[model samples]
Target: MKSLLRLTLSVLIISLVACSILQREGRYFSHPSTISKVDAIGSIPVRISLEQNWTDQTRMDFWFTSQGSRIIPYSWFMWLEQADSRALFRDAGHMEQLRYLPVASSAVNPAGLPIGFALDTDTQTGDAWLGLTCAACHTNQLDYQGTKILIEGAPTLANFVLFYQRLVNALTVTGKDDAKFERFAKRVLASDYSAESAAELRNSVLQISLAVAQRQLVNALPATYPADFTSYARLDAFGNIQNAASAFALHDLTNRNPPTAPVSYPFLWGTHQSDVVQWNASAPNTPIVGPLVRNIGEVVGVFGDLSITEAPWWQRVLGKKNSYSSTVKMLGLGHLEAWVKDLRSPQWPQQYLPGIDATKAAQGSVIYQQQCASCHQVITRSDEGQDYIAVKTPLIEVGTDPAMAWNAAHHKANTLILEGTKKDIIVGDKFSVQAPAIELAVNGVVGLVLKNPGEALKAGLIPEEHGKRSLLADELSSIEDYLQVNLAAREKLTVATKAASLLSESELHGLVYKARPLNGIWATAPYLHNGSVPNLWELLQLPEERIAEFWVGSREFDPVRVGYRVDQGLSKFRVRDDGGEVTPGNSNLGHRYGTELSDQQKWSLIEYMKTL
Candidate 1:
């Protein structure tokens, strides 16, 4: 029953819990560790998972959850991972921690700065884990293909700074000055650096080389940080989000507190329709009908605990419920409850993604297989690579190998630890790095990676661009189920819609597991876990060698189109520091990387990708 809840959190197959609550219906506090993660005891109204709750055509909640789903204080999530062996799920803890960074005072405009960027000093003893979260990723932004966006799955404040600087550079007044860039980067980096240094030693080093650049950026900005001007200020004031959004805003809080319905994305392949379809979309809304898998799990922040379900969970590794009852301090505040609540965060505008050219996708698959298959397992096509999945694939940068993938993700994720510790890779709270895997963190998956990078990856655990250790291989597997089964369930509706011309057969709409068939690889760029990148041609054009700080509004060219001026790229780059000598940033985004990719290959890949 315990593993059931864990299984539910590990995948996105089916929705199990509602948006407002934390656990599945009838399930109580059930994290494996000292800090248990459960929903409010009988909190919400209807009982379905959130993904279905919102994505369903009705968009109705029989039970009313408070804010949208950001509540369940992240420290609670950290404990959930911790219960599973925090060191093994190192990066996962880092990521989940961000979701619950405390509001500094909840009394001012930027009441919630998130522990990472808060102006407070008392955070040392607060959820202390919250400070650890920022160190887990935000030393700087990940410059994928020269674009200044943060790593897709990992939300970083550095990207916001790069975006701000680029915008300032575009303005005539700020364009002429290079000093600010250096000043800005450094200050943020320093803040992050100082925040992450801890008393303990590590098992391995997972570092990012943002040390110098950080110094340069802060030194340049006059108003610098926490000022009314500059988006950097917004990041300082608002934490890792855009405009007025906070990942832990009031909306996110309320929904997670007393969820409206059961919202887990449980897997449904093996179960008999009668046996597994309780969350049906029929008049009664049974769960079974046409589900993705027999497994009742989820991918979003949805929760599920089989302890509450009719069936019994086979794996019962966790022993007790004390973890749920324990109080973890947060944001320098004491006695934080594991109780789920709602935090209403800001919402990004929903701009529908226009469809990509189908023809081009076909052309992209060949390249995709060659470059991407090493990490992503092809579920639809044979290993020899013969079939055609309609959409071009290539989103997940991880595969069936969990041990190794976790290691790779940790090296990238725990850069602050790498910088601060510069030594041993801490495995688990009790064990150090062992023969197979490298324990990367004292508390979570970081230790697992440090202990056995290879083994972890083999198990199929890799961080999504957002830095959560959910495997791409499994996601692909479920998507197949979701695509085929979900469609089958709605087959009658689809047929009726076409027959009635409510929508032409060709003009139909449906959800696919969040991936495309990647046979046509080249045309699918810009790449991202989230659809943040724009075009393939632009991706191919970026520089290969450097890990840059993607600046959105620099004075160079905008490889990806943007309406703003100063859409510069890597070419005209220059950085100054130390003795004030000018050094290069990225010359191009990532064009130079595909040295093996010839003009014909690149073109052919692009052409082929569209067909998929």
Candidate 2:
């Protein structure tokens, strides 16, 4: 036992040392000199009005409320530095440098931790944790002539990969450097500062830092694969989520797969109303259960604590199942879903941008009906309960990159560890030795929902029509229905594939990306599912004619082009498609619908899109 203890300690020390070395060598910390120059480039004062249904209080709740993701202890995040320097990691001045929008402290956000950062306190332990809310990735700000326009539900430019890497680096450094640890301890413990407390804090920081570092290694693309960075405004969400649930939670490294298929974050405006969501339309948005399951899965992916373990002997004897535990906040997730149901799309800011040319817009409206209206439907902004079933266009029909869809549809994982566990602790089925990664992820999320019945009930998971039924029965029915819908959607995609029989099952099922309503599409730049096209002007041109390379981290908008300005020297996130061997997730191809239009016709369509 003593020898084993020594071995474990040695391995941990070695890992921490390696992580510290990697932090020093890699671009994990931002230099103070490289702070963004966006604010210094003169300001444009303009009155902004967003046409959204939610009130000020709702928006505040959405922005700051926690979804039970605990990235780190709240106090540590408040005091950590940039690894090599004493500069605060959460400093607003360097927010733009990290591609996150900076916001002032308000009544709702006393910590002033950027737009998406939220404080979650453990109800049992009273420990405050810092985690991200949906707004971190969904809310966006565009700089038009030094005037910032805040758009709810739009994809943000924040570089998630960079943010996470820097955080780990800071924690690793604080653990290794005595001076940094002393300062961090002082800030975190203030009144309770003691030698024993300092040692305990150091151990906590090192353990979490090491764990996150190990997870990053598991999610990384194999050394043989090309370096495919997710960069700003994009994330391989499904890939990461599956990895967290199957590999990290299950303690099975072999279940890990490279998170190579990063896609642009979808806007949330009409998402709740849509029958399906996600780039591939894998999730079914069925009333209450649908949104709750989807959000819980998202929370799991974004550093939410999830643990899948063997069922206890007592549980087994009692026939109770599901040993899956998670820190997912059920009521918070439900509130967020409710808020999103009424969140309206941002209309064109006519006061800030050029006025629409009525003649051109009218002509473009006709072209839209002829060329675009079939797949991308229009939605009524005010209709909160309107059902908008998204149209799924096959990958062959809309020739965009098939990587994202393919990966989600086909990625498999070893479920041997969960073999005897109920497929969903609440309802139907049981796990086999092997299953799709998505299946395991769904199972994990379902377990979380079922485990917290009281929270689920409070979160409005029980539908009005099902109120008469027992909570367990209603929850079980919802899970079964949701699973069936997901299975049916996958089958539909598989059946619709026109690919040759020689193609794999993964390729067949991945042959579709959903076409959603284009309302507020103008705010979501670098178009297409993978965000390969830089602007609407270029997107209207042939895919072959589009710029092969452009930077993506800038928030400065080009109103004329209807996208963010892509300046090579100003941004670090350079998206390239040399047309040799297509980059796994960054292919700038397909969606040939409007590319053949005349320049005049294309410009008209662009003007018309601004109205949406």
- 22-119: candidate 2 lDDT, tens digit per residue: 43342221221221122211122232447677787777789888998877766677678888788888777556677666565565554556778887
The 10-residue segment of model 2 with minimum total lDDT is 34-43
lDDT of 2: 0.73
Q: Stretches of candidate 2 above 4 Å error?
A: 1-49, 224-228, 420-422, 425-430, 461-510, 568-579
**C-alpha lDDT values of all predictions:** 0.23, 0.73
What local lDDT score does residue 168 receive in model 2, on the 0 to 100 scale? 81
| Model 1 C-alpha RMSD to native | 21.9
Model 2 clash pairs? Answer: none
